[model samples]
Target chain A: MPSLPDMATPEAERLAQEAAQPADPHITDVALKPALFDWLCRMGDGALILGHRTSEWCGHGPALEEDIALANTALDLIGHAALWLELAAEVEAQGRTADDLAYLRDAMRFRNPQIVELPNGDIGRTLMREFLYDAWHYEMLLKLRDSSSPRVAEIAAKAGKEVAYQLDRASDLVIRLGDGTEESHARMQAALDHLWPYTGELFTDDAVDEAVAEAGIAPRASELQGPWDATLREVMGEATLTVPDRRADVHLGGKQGRHTEHLGYILAEMQFLQRAYPGAEW
Target chain B: MVTDTLPSTDTIRNWLGEVPDPEIPVISVTDLGIVRDISWQGDTLVVAVTPTYSGCPATAFINMEIEAKLRDKGIEDFRIERRLSPPWTSDWLTPEAREKLRAYGIAPPIDGTAPDGRTAARAARLAGRSNLAVDCPRCGSTDTEKVSQHGSTPCKAAYRCRDCLEPFDYFKCI
Candidate 1:
């Protein structure tokens, strides 16, 4: 309906190529395809939702430089989302396109972890949330470069380059702001403490994670925690910020399609055009 | 004689060499190395293009230009594929293209500093190391400082000449 390339014709040439190549045993298991699709959706959804939130700062950043930087980060995240979702659609072997998955899904159908969907409160809070998420995201991408699925590896490698820059910038700003004025420091600290509860959701693993881990498509989410912790310890140490004690996530379930009300509001604004006029294109 | 009407890959490549980047009109897309591979897929001409930045708005325009170029050559059966693996790097910019960028008042990406492959092996850059200096394209001053990591375009960084104090764009490495 969105003017997608016709994929209904199952060409014998492609079928023959698929039949001829020896499949990766981990991913070729037909039962695991659904799990893989879910896993890919989680990756793409996180990027998209967070990207939308970051873009909200487009004209509103505290300064010109900050505004431009935030916009660039948003663009990169949205770009990464497109790649991940396109691969997800391919893995599903359905007629759905990446645009369909991104624009048509309801709040309950999204697989992004809850941390990404929470509202961006203030500049300090936004930066604090960004720092925490960047650490985990970078670690996840680093490990994903070795994914058994070469396509996954390829995307990870590409996105990892960009995330490295994002993580570095976020860490630098967090340190500067957290150690700046007493007022700025207090606000940053408050942001870290407030956002800590949601951080756990990023590493919370489930049946989908188990499937992807077993299939070598991705590392178990928990495995990224150690690296995430090390990066956090280093960054927070320099920022003079105290990270809240690690605890089980009470604000969870986004990955499982149970999200905070914030996500519904976000989807309302994000999916408005697609919903208002189906198949609409600029 | 009739079968020889098909153009060679090199000829198609030359045709593409004439298409300038939408953002930087002075430089051709082929010189930027976004045009990755040209081959014949069955009877159709296949052109593989890569994006400089993941979210670059120019990609759609680039694709259209490539399609138009092919159409101009009477090749209607061509397919343009977006190739993502191996990733596009600033390192791929041609020597002549880099010179052109410099002359256009935008510093070319620092040679051999586009952040190497993978993170584990790239600790030095990942550790907040700066690229030392970006010479001002206007006054050719090595005393320039970075204004910001991002510039007007995603691929460029804002900078200013320390000597002339004039702002300029630096094509970012990576």
Candidate 2:
């Protein structure tokens, strides 16, 4: 048989567009503030890097369903990165599209944090990252829903539901592995220790966050931590895993455009198509 | 805001509901409650809606559907904007729509604990409602269990009915 793609691909793409664009502008002031734009860029940078890392597991996942799951999550995060980049473009007021921001930037220029670029070490590491990121995203969206900027709030409102589900999945896995067997629990704990430091950086403040919060575009990062803690505790307890002790070594500065060494390599692959074919459009 | 020889807002809104949700073909976007405000900005019929997820793959098709549906209705000059704040909640689901979703076998999302101090509304809603227990659509029994935290889609969960020994999908909230 010729394959389901013939039946599903076009329809899937069509559906994708429909669910994204609305018939009306939620917040019609087309102008994007520079600081807010930077914040968006920073956030996109993190998401896109994380997405690229996850996509590397396309054919390498332990199971078929899991392979698709990782790929799907990768697509969702990248798609979100693209949307945020589009918002950034508007803020720049330079007529740049999302493609321009995503494809044009060089490695050293990326603002994503170090955590996202870390190699997908093992299933344990992937689960660790997912647990942290999903919880962070869920809390952030909850705060974002009340954003002064109605546009951000709307995006959070819709995205929040999906994030919640993702978190639940990740949390379930964490619990299973932490309580599964000696080997799995050890691996999970190791992964947690390796990844925990990065969590602090996710909630760090920068000028963009300040401006965006002031503008009502989003909430302060500080406000998210309390809820994040509660959520993490709930999940950890269920998983029978002790939460990683709060680390003093805070990994900060991604929001300020500084990133780790791995970001360069990731960006090289991500931006290659765009840079090679300037102004390329599908 | 009536114009010369133009139809009323009510008529326009009714026509707009003709647009079906691109993913769930069984229901219209209006039925999903994603369609928020519908108004005219000049000749353009601007319809406001929120996506079910930030990175939902169906976004592209939803936009096309809206455009095609409106164009078919002889209205163009339309634009679809993605809204993020006051974020779309499952609580916005209409009772009629919820009933349809349940009949369709998709367990609708239970509302979140309100973050905006709307304890009164939440309390009122909780008080007035019962049957939060979801029935497995496949087996038509409330003795259903969540199989996995993740389902085939981001918005759904894998569920199995103990009574009927059938597995189904449940729509979940973030």
Candidate 3:
């Protein structure tokens, strides 16, 4: 557990207050549970890894606008991770700060998918990844709004809007790239071919899903796949790219915390501060 | 002093309606869909708010503003919960608030209600058959090109004028 500053300060009181208020009774009630905690941690880890990956594009984007957009989205994902990590900390009753969970966790312990951990290959590849993730994330949030768990629903409702924006941007980029020129179209198709194998991992389920689903707090990952595929297909078609045929015999274990080699590096950069200066605060 | 029932949560909510968002002063946090709910847990008042985006940077300030505003009203035991699960959306932009955003030199977020809310309306109110005129903020020229999908901040995008060659920000609908 990370040691926070003295709890008597005005700021601490404010933070406590902010964390204590519950939303709609119906939604908030169902969201509070042990299962939700684990789900949030997994979800937060995913966002944190992806945020770090996207942040790498800060000054290297093909265009100024794209640079800002990717940076802003990275910031948004980081913010989302902080929120979910806070919830996860609260679940354990461990008093861990969002910074603690985000910066302290080691690589092997993280549950973010290998796809997010992968480097942004190219502008077209980056856009395709964003399109696929945003499509799933946006659609998930939409469904989550009506979830039995109000807290989850509430967060989903709010996140749905952001993901919707991301989806639109991805859609625009896909169309622009797929229809822009022959080279661009060919590159996008190649990007799809490269990214296709990893897409299977997104929906693969295991023990964690079993736990969360039984709790009624999180919908199954498989449940989100159909819509995810449909959306991806439509966008890829518009981009003049064909969806790469499903690559069978591919291993899937992101949900189980078995990640790609890149995750280690991403975690090292993210966790360096916490491990170096244990309990250090800005 | 004779004891009386504390003001209902609704009363506190009504009082909070006076607190507007710091950036877009024309809109209140309530109208922005950030404020989730207000309630009383014993003598303590709890206010729930969600940030427009995760790591919005404005959230810390918004949380402080809520505390100060409520404290100003003499309600000290109040709490503010910043929930981030269901993220904030542009759909929450109230009709009046949307107009205010536009007037503030930021193109109001498109309601996702088909792309032609202002472009078509402004066209119908114009003399030409084409409806793409964006009415330049500086020179009032209809000729413009969206130069970038990003601007000075995450919430806005950039547009350039073909007529006057001036660049301005469009508050995108996110």
lDDT of each: 0.81, 0.66, 0.68
Most accurate candidate by DockQ: 1
Listed per model in order, the count of residue pairs whose N, CA or C atoms clash below 3 Å is 0, 38, 16
Kindly report the fnat of each predicted structure, to 2 decimals: 0.26, 0.27, 0.44
TM-score of each: 0.90, 0.77, 0.80
Better of 2 and 3 by DockQ: 3
Q: What is residue B24's positional error in candidate 3, in angstroms? A: 5.3
Give the 10-residue window scoring lowest on summed lDDT in candidate 3 chain A.
A1-10
User: Mind giving the per-residue lDDT tens digits that candidate 1 earns over A142-175?
Assistant: 9999999877887888888888778876887788
Question: Per-residue lDDT of B72-148 in model 3, one digit per residue for the tens?
Answer: 77776766666555455667777877666656665566565322211322233244322234556666677876766
Interface RMSD, in order shown: 6.7, 8.4, 7.0
Per-residue accuracy of model 2 over A90-185 as CA lDDT, tens digit each: 557686666667777776556776678788899989988888887878777778777676556655665565555566557767777877899998
Candidate 3 chain B lowest-lDDT run of ten: B114-123
Give the least accurate 10-residue stretch of model 1 chain A, judged by summed lDDT: A3-12
Question: Weakest 10 consecutive residues, lDDT, candidate 2 chain B?
Answer: B113-122
Instruction: Using TM-score, give the best candidate's number.
Output: 1
Sort by lDDT, best first: what order? 1, 3, 2
lDDT, candidate 2, equals: 0.66
Cα miss at A132, model 3 (Å)? 2.1
- In candidate 3, stretches whose alpha carbon ends up further than 4 angstroms from where it belongs are A1-10, A17-36, A246-251, B1-47, B68-75, B83-103, B112-136, B139-144, B162-164
